[model samples]
Target: METEPSAALMSAIVTEHFVLQSGAGTTVSEALGRSSLYLSALSSSLIALGFAAQTPGLLLPFAAAALPTVFVLGVFTMVRLVGTGVQNMLYLSGISRIRGYYRTLDPEAARYFARWGAGDGETDDALGSLAVRGGPMAGLFTAASMIAVINGVLAGVGLALLTYYVVTDHHLPAALAVGLVAMTAGLAMFFRYQHRCYLRVQR
Candidate 1:
């Protein structure tokens, strides 16, 4: 014979559901905070670079020192944000499972949480509504993608400045070409990492 869930079991399930939801929200907030910190640092660096540019003999040295630092910071931020995204997805999945259990306890509970249930289709649709469309291109629209692109540009520009000032004899054309190549390579590397992260999430 079928029996109702014990009160203690129900209380535990409710607590787990609340914890998972809180975790998901915390991950999102953390991602935003980390991104903001990275951007604030980048902006301050750019402003300092602007000031350095006005002073003779300071621009090259300051840029040479600052650009690499900013790029490294960006790399760290991007990686952490990707991890946060993964954590949030896991939390959401747990919450969805709990909602499914709730529906099992009361058939009418499905109406209130119509989007999420034991059915994979309903869960996927609910998640899709919350995030971008899934595919190879989905990662490109994330905050991590934005940081990766900016870091790539910084790397390229840093290389170009070094080439023009130290390696080449101030050859603008050669430096430009080198910078473009570096930027392309950096972007490719970052995108590859993001793709791998996306694949993990898919699994």
Candidate 2:
């Protein structure tokens, strides 16, 4: 049987992990929001221009050709958003774990984590809120939710355009359905990617 680790070693490990968690959480969450904004802008521009590119007489073939490009770009953008989301989740998991250790060390400190107050009004804005209920982390997640919604809208538009093209040019109903599924997979991708992150934070 292996010997038990010393209390000092355990404490050192916890402190190191806590610092790592704080750094990663802050960095990745900001990166996720920034990237999401960039992709949202990119997709919006593409959508607007794709429609503008339509000619009065050549609408059908032009839009049909644009459908594939739109769908591919939409899927690619959404994949990056989902990947960034997963990294954010990892950061949240670290934060959750560190918060647990803090509470374990001193249950009374939980109140301070929610709000640090030394009777100074300045501390109100300076201290970060650790309350999982509608705190800064909540805002991070809300941003993610909004990003996902925008991505879903883009995917839906892609599906409609692709479906129109498939019906007009391919003459196949089954192909249209498959195209819908493939184009609208953004939400599916988000849920699948974030599921593990949710579980990690929960634990």
Candidate 3:
């Protein structure tokens, strides 16, 4: 007679799977939130800077403006790339491949999945849910990243244009310098708050 899986073995398998799923879900959620905040701050800063650029007779600090915008654009691009990579890892199913993918997935997801086999759903449905969550999060990250890049480049162009006028004794105005300084302070505060939130979550 063929031997069947013992009750203990089946339970253990289900438990392991449940734990993994829970962990993954939580991780995706956290990453989504972080990316959202980063995007929001970038958007607001860009908008404020753009407005300051439009007013006639405002001083624009080309180098200072370009520096932070470039840095933020690069960071945003990197975040999107990482987000896409994470989503891809989540969808693959080969044994070794799955192991690698799990490394990128939320640690809590793996543990949660380990603990619950189907979690009250068909096998296919359970897997589908995880994919659904991952895909949307990746898309949101990509959209925000792209917008940030565009805004940064545009802001740089504006600053550069303004600089030519200022240098030729168009009588450099104080607005550019003051605006950049203010924006920097705002960004610092935004990041500080974000860091605090992350720590709270960790705790």
**Candidate 1 lDDT, tens digit per residue, 29-121?**
998999999889989999999999999999988898888888899989989988887777778777777776777777688787665323364
Better structure of 2 and 3 per lDDT: 2
RMSD vs true structure, all candidates: 2.4, 8.8, 12.7
The parts of candidate 3 lying over 4 Å away from their true place are 54-59, 62-70, 73-203
> For model 2, how does the per-residue alpha-carbon lDDT over 1-203 read when each residue is reduced to its tens digit?
54555799778867777776676566566656665665666566667666766756455565456545654554555455545544554554454445555555555967754433232222221222333342234433534455555656656655555555655565456555655675358666765555545444434
lDDT of 3 by residue, 1-203 (tens): 54655789657655655666565566556556656666666667667667767776432553356446655654564455445434433432222233333434565656544422233223223334444332213333343344444444445444444554554444345446544554455444434433343233222
True-vs-predicted CA distance for residue 51, candidate 2, Å: 7.0
TM-score quality measure for candidate 3: 0.42
Model 2 has an lDDT value of 0.53
Q: How many collisions per candidate?
A: 0, 0, 29
Q: Which model is ahead, 1 or 3, in terms of lDDT? A: 1
Identify the runs in model 1 with alpha carbons over 4 angstroms from their true place. 116-126
lDDT of 2 at 192: 58
Estimate the overall C-alpha local distance difference test score of candidate 3: 0.46
